[model samples]
Target: LFAIAFALLRKYPTNEEEDFDRLIDNWSRREQPLFIERALPAVTPNNDEPPPDYHSEENLLVFNQAIADYLVTSGYTVSCKEFCREANISINDSADKKDQLEKKWTSVIRLQKKVMDLELKLQEALQEATVGGPTREKRSPGEWIPRPPEKFELRGHRDTVTHVVFHPTFDVIASASEDATIKIWDYESGEHERTLKGHTAPVQDIAFDHTGKWLLSCSADMSIRLWDFQTYQCIKTMHGHDHNVSSVTFTPSGDHIISSSRDKTIKIWEVSTTFCIKTLTGHREWVRMVRVYQDGTLIASASVDHTIRIWSLPSGECKSELRGHENVVECIAWANDSAGPYISEPIANGGTEVCSFLVLQVVCW
Candidate 1:
């Protein structure tokens, strides 16, 4: 429920952003040689509004394995039809039962077989291609470069990693996974500092307000939760999103929150008052992303239907629609910020340039 004691970094001017970026970029992505690593047992779930029980996932896996072993030991090899018939299971054509269906089953055994066969064949193919075909530098068109990921990892989420976020002002990373908990990690130090468990459903989405003082989460359980990031406690549950709440965001002023849901509506709530200030209903499909401008004057919405729309804030007037992206516009970023004096100045060899220095000098004593 508490962050381990550490020094907080001071915010520097935009001109010094390069320095900060360099510091973080040069920060070793490699981990130190620490002694033993251990998986701490997570806290028991609270049933009050519990997310599904992922705690018993291991037990379920073990049971399945035991069942498979028993079947194998009894000299009953799984013929798809026999397996389903003996099990007295019926799967609709849409959701087929692996063993009974004509389609290749994506089972544990089948998956392992696929991996072994693919790897074996790929090795031979690579050898043949290398011996008789063109070299890497002399390859023909359509050759894969085999470049590795910029940043990829096997994140150890027992179930699903529902949400991932970087800290507003720190190198810290937070993720809420279907393990029915939230976890904070120091990606720089490769240290998992804390795991937060409270929500009972898969946390759909999460956001930090402008100041990063508070965190908000919406879950499939049709509830919006307010969490005090410092204390790591759920302080409030704003239960208005009737269906699965898909996304939640705090306004720039941190006084209000805008949330979108499978309920096909977006609700703006006054956080301090915990009251629904306005409900925006227009999208035919699920509204995926809702963002408020820094001035709190505009709200931008992106949906599954591939169009983006902007709405006037607080008043809930539909303002304008932005058309371009040809897919589900799940994300939007207002990256353009007015440059202050400290950010940068342009160089001019032949023509005049707007001087931020002059503007600052005129405004200052």
Candidate 2:
């Protein structure tokens, strides 16, 4: 009878093995006679009467009571009907109770999935907000977007303007034109302040000194002119190019100026002496534009030969030659010292379309 009760305890799953063992021990002490009469008939050999019914109402009552006592001792406050259902026992109202339990479990699982989905959506919304949200300008399919309107126009040039430059330290601007003049203007008010006239031919390019006190202009008349910007007077005229002077720029130190010409040469001149200090000659065609490094250590020139040459300043030695443009390289501009430099050239087959290339590094020879 004890072995049969132990086997019955091992067959059922409970929260803890020790709790079940304690339950069996309590049952043995409280219902020893009931267990012996109900569970030992199968193993008794000489009994002539039929074995007691295992499913009798009296046996069922004893089983339910035993489970109720175990739950109370284990600190569980479940009702008798709940404990019977947990043990898989069939009672009068068990089917309805089982249906209700199944519905409740299904609802809980569905609600948990919905909560996870909502959490995911909320995370995505927060990420979008942190990343500055969607773009403000949305274009429709096949719509033609127009370019932004110009802020203001300066209209003092009587002919096609060759170049325009802003003073480094002031609100003044200077513009060169084919009308044989350079016009200085108050850029903030769009008022033409003065017209500088010295070149017999069209002025090609203009530049301002580092101190913004002087200006330089090169012209097709084969001469470079330095002007006092404050007094609007030509201070010095430099004549060295055999052909048209195309471009000119002052060095960052304001002690020298560099000029390029259709004669295929670049001349570095002393600002005070007005004498050519060095001449860089390597381009096979006309040099179009020239720019100096901020530290006055390097100079770069663009040419009609479809190449750009980097030269060491004051040494006149070519450091490197950059060649990839299909047409004449026309302009070069440098960003801040940390941002590198770029050059622009017109494409050979594309009308009026220009392509810019970045100058990554210059290796000295």
Candidate topping lDDT:
2
lDDT of 2 by residue, 299-359 (tens): 8888999888888896789878877777877777655676444434343455332222243
lDDT of 2: 0.74
List residue ranges in candidate 1 displaced over 4 A: 1-154, 323-327, 339-365
lDDT (CA) per prediction: 0.61, 0.74
lDDT of 1: 0.61
- Candidate 1 residue lDDT tens string, 263-344: 7788999998888888998887887777776667777776776555667786797755544445566655553345332112
Compared with the true structure, model 2 gives a TM-score of 0.56
lDDT of candidate 1 at residue 283, scale 0 to 100: 81
Q: Which portions of model 2 show Cα errors greater than 4 Å?
A: 1-148, 341-364
The superposed Cα distance between candidate 1 and the true structure at residue 55, in angstroms, equals: 77
Candidate 1, residue 25: CA error in Å? 38
Where is model 2 poorest over a 10-residue stretch in terms of lDDT? 351-360
For the record, the alpha-carbon RMSD of candidate 2 to the native fold, in angstroms, is: 23.1
Q: Could you tell me which residue pairs clash in candidate 1?
A: 50-200, 51-200, 51-201
Please give the range of 10 consecutive residues that has the lowest summed lDDT in model 1: 1-10
